[model samples]
Target: MTQDKHSRRRMLAMVGGALAMPSVLRAQATDPTVVGGTAEARRNISSFRTQRWEDHFDSLGVATLLADTQSRALHYWSADGSDYRLYPTSVPMSEELTKRGYTKVVRKRVGPDWTPTQNMLARDPSLKYMPPGPDNPLGTHALYLDWPAYLIHGTHDTRKIGRRSSSGCIGLYNEKIAELYELAPVGTQVRLI
Candidate 1:
């Protein structure tokens, strides 16, 4: 009967759609969502580019952070002659930090505590003190540079890495910065060009 065939077709379609819905839900759950205030989505896969082929240090034996404002990425060099596979990281940028020149690491701290600057608090009093943790702005490690206004540090939100959303200091993915923190000692020179 025509009526019976139409009912059977509608039931089959509903069953098929219902079976497919869970897969779509699972994919959305697995994918990471946006965090903090990032303009771009986070990328997991990265290919390293040759920033410098020769050891420009000439075996001076000091790790360095070569931060490029234009690229919004930081390149790390090991004084020990070990080459690291490249990972493109998102770096924070602002109008004032376009030219930082060269600065040295003044201090280093792990699980660094974060307190909003008086200047920051003045502007946004609603911002509260954030304790150190996975949610902390400073993330796992922080390397203070000679410039008090800025430093090289890790971020809790991996999404913010490639975005120009930080107050001023450059931020790296948590694992990347942690690796650098262990390798780079205080007084390591950081050049921004």
Candidate 2:
């Protein structure tokens, strides 16, 4: 009877360790300085905290957007400082794919088309131009940044939100992008960190 109890305890211990292994692997794989996917990853990456715009911008000229790639959250403050909003976002999959610095919303587009970047084409030669529609990767609205080929846009793939899924652009949900598109006009100052 004692042997049977020990055997059961050993089995439970092995199962518990097996269940804990993924989290251990994920923690080791995650970079505290960069955003990551999954709820556990979020906890590991700063708990998706909110930040003040003043810390990122000298003034809320027109508007301000701070994309905290580390936390996978976007912070927005209106020009008048009366409105502040935070949204979960999908950041670049890797640090090399991320662009960190200040830029501005130079333009905005509704139902934007998707054209593979030069690097994207080089990687997948089969990639072709995609027109604006459900199949488009840019979703319902797009906020074009001063950096060419980089954007704060919507994605039809809701699964991408809160995950490290984008090639280089920051992605939001379709409805959220539409709302943001209406709020953030041209020349909204943006910083990606």
Candidate 3:
């Protein structure tokens, strides 16, 4: 009887240990480089928590963009309205997007230099302008909008995607934003809700 009790206890303990392994594995999975991931390219990628293509708007017309602050996702529609795709993005954690509704792309830049906004400088005066580079906060491309002090740009940091982590700018992954740069032109309609 004692032997049977011990065997059951051992089985239960092993099962419990197995159940606990996933959380441990997930934590380890997040940083492949730090976790000694040789093929750490996978960890460097960021994604959206949710994505779907339904009639998400009254009119995501040709050459239009819809940035959802709640989901931290960006959806772009083509000129002909044939192709619509979703991409993960990061938005301002603290910046109020009060000037919402309709806006348009005013200009665009490749490998854009990042100048700290007045608000940013207010928090840290020493943070001067950042030159364009792989490490530049505005990763590879940027689409400046008519909205003052706002931009849709790229980031070297993939960890911020699908999260509220930006100072007010909308950010995408390097690869994704590069693709968006090609698709979005100057004067494209952008709606932020």
Candidate 4:
């Protein structure tokens, strides 16, 4: 009977130890790189003064403007802005924007198609692209801001929008961007303040 009790205790100890191993390993496996060892990374994560888009509005042929409150970055588009599109830096179309009276929202797919490549883009370049159509990253409509290689468009990344989410482009809901695109004319000025 004593032998049986000893054996049971040994089994329990082994099981308990096994269960604890994962947590121990996880705690030790934390990457030091994520702690922001580099100066650039530190700057990227630092907080700045809050800014509102409405604060700066120059009616001098100004058509539209996209502003990011978090990053204090602005993307300005003019009737003759360029003929391309201007994307906001790190601003995503968010629910907060909608709740705050932004009736028009655009959603687009601005990520890579392949899973592995997409993951690579997220980790390394921090850049995203809109897919071609409905499944495209640039959702239903894209607000062409007249900037080469930049666009204020809708995104399917509903979660990422409204936050400092994108690499340097402004993101919106697919539907909203389309609506805005229709309303905004070619000469419409966009100011990202």
The lDDT of each candidate is: 0.70, 0.89, 0.78, 0.48
Q: Over the stretch 1-193, how does candidate 4's per-residue lDDT look in tens digits?
A: 9999999999999999999987665444212343455522112222322333344544424345555445534444444445323333336344332211121222222332312244346566755553465566555555544453346666777765546665345666665565556556555544443
**Candidate 2 lDDT (Cα, whole model)?**
0.89
Best by lDDT: 2
lDDT of 3 by residue, 55-170 (tens): 34455444788887865779888877788788889988874633457788999999899888887888889888889997798999999999787899999999988888888788
For model 4, the local distance difference test gives 0.48
Best of the candidates, TM-score = 2
- Work out the TM-score per prediction: 0.65, 0.77, 0.69, 0.42
Give candidate 3's total backbone clashes. 0
Native-to-model Cα distance after best TM-score fit, residue 108 in candidate 2, in Å = 0.6
Error of model 1, residue 46, in angstroms: 7.4
Candidate 3 regions exceeding 4 Å error are 1-62, 95-99
Q: Write the residue-wise lDDT of candidate 2 on 21-93 in tens digits.
A: 9877555433334436532332443347647687778899999999989788898999999999988899999
Worst 10 residues of 3 by lDDT: 41-50
Q: Which pairs clash (backbone N, Cα, C closer than 3 Å) in model 1? A: 90-161, 90-162
Higher-ranked by lDDT: 3 or 4: 3
lDDT of 4 at 79: 45
RMSD of model 2 against the true structure: 6.1
- For candidate 1, write residues 10-69 as lDDT tens digits: 999999999998766544422335577643333332322235524333332477677765
